[model samples]
Target: MPKVPKWVADVLENVFSGFNRKVIVAEINHLHPFIKTIKFRGDLSGVNFKPGQAISIRVNETNFRNYTPSFWDSENGVFEVIFHLHGNGPGSSYIDGLELDDLVNIVLPRGLDLYKKEYEYHFFFGDETTIGLFKSLKQVIEENGQNYIGILELNEDTMHYELKTRYGLDIVSSSINKAQNAISFLQNLPDRVWELWQNGSFYLMGNGRSIQNFRKALKEKGVNSRNIRTQPYWVEGKIGL
Candidate 1:
């Protein structure tokens, strides 16, 4: 076993505790296409996360995906994650055979997961793969009566993941051909969500190329680059995330 020093142990406990015996209680595909929500039966009292950060899950070092925590009902001891099934990669393939009580490893959640502390509006742009982040953000903003627009892309009929939308959310359809659709969404939105890109920081997570285009679209409209934040799930022409 690997021995940890005292200071390191406390930091790990504060930052992340890779509890060796974590298990899955249930796993199901959601209403949205190509996404699956995995529910875990773990010790929830130790769970902690900000709005947009995620945990890096690993079957092994090579087989891991940064998963955004989709929902957290701490009192009920439940937490969920939404994932997109794009190929036979670490995240999708690993999720396939997950049965109740299956054990797995989770990297402690870390990042600057933030939204507006004081803002009137918010908007989200992402597809099936980025929906995990979208779901978490939508819930927080909606409860505060904030404005939101979520752009989602998917294939014809792949189903996975569930979003609790009170006022509901705007879902824009998209595909790998992001340039074409992104252009359309930016030009025609009068009801803009500024919290994500104003004094408050917005988070971006997904394929690098698509994110590049999305950033360009906003920049052309004269939005500041500092206002937009991104975490790339995959880059263009790359495999296994």
Candidate 2:
């Protein structure tokens, strides 16, 4: 999706019901050189959002991207989204260009069902793109008194601030090493991590190859396929998933 210029978004907002939202950029934080957070405020009264749901933003007349909310307050009509500005495409440029007080149009939230309250133990695995989902999961898991663990693969520059000190997730962060396949790193994870993998329902998101490798390891340890759930957010060489 291409980035939508403000003038065109404003004109189309009046004609398309899907573009009815008028969100003001309340705050923006540069969490890292490659990661940023955006806070949006508006009349979000009619919106029905869930922990894992994502909103599609019109970057341009023909381009758009889906992003999950890291946090939100329905009563206050505000939400925050953490973006991984990889600087590889138009979407990155669009997000990088956004400033405080900017207005934009976004579609209503939509995504796969990720949470199952019946499960007493939960496991989450993903990369940087999975941070928002992890944040949301942590809140729900704590609120419901469920046991959960997260394992993430992030580039060295973003891993510490994201999973370690910031969110304080009980996670195993493997920094990406240029000489090795990231998925291969999963096979050498601590024995205890493998032990826990067999005892809970797994939610795997992020890089397709990494998810496949992790899921394969779980299955080899006798975890039923039914015990695992996944949504591949992106694939190498593929635009989106």
**Among all candidates shown, the one with the greatest lDDT:** 2
The residue-by-residue lDDT of candidate 2 on 101-204, one tens digit each, is 99987776777768877788887878788888888877888899988766677766665564666666544445343213333544665888667656678888
TM-score winner: 2
TM-score of each: 0.76, 0.83
Q: lDDT of each model, Cα atoms only?
A: 0.62, 0.75
Those runs of model 2 whose alpha carbons end farther than 4 Å from true positions after fitting are 1-20, 170-197
Q: Where does model 1 exceed 4 Å of error?
A: 1-21, 156-177, 191-203, 239-241
Q: For candidate 1, what is the TM-score?
A: 0.76
**Candidate 2 lDDT score at position 142:** 83
- Candidate 2 lDDT at 231 equals 80
lDDT of 1 by residue, 39-157 (tens): 77665566566777776665433344567787776566667887677777555677765767787666656777667646565656565677767778878887887765555544455
Candidate 1's clash total is 7
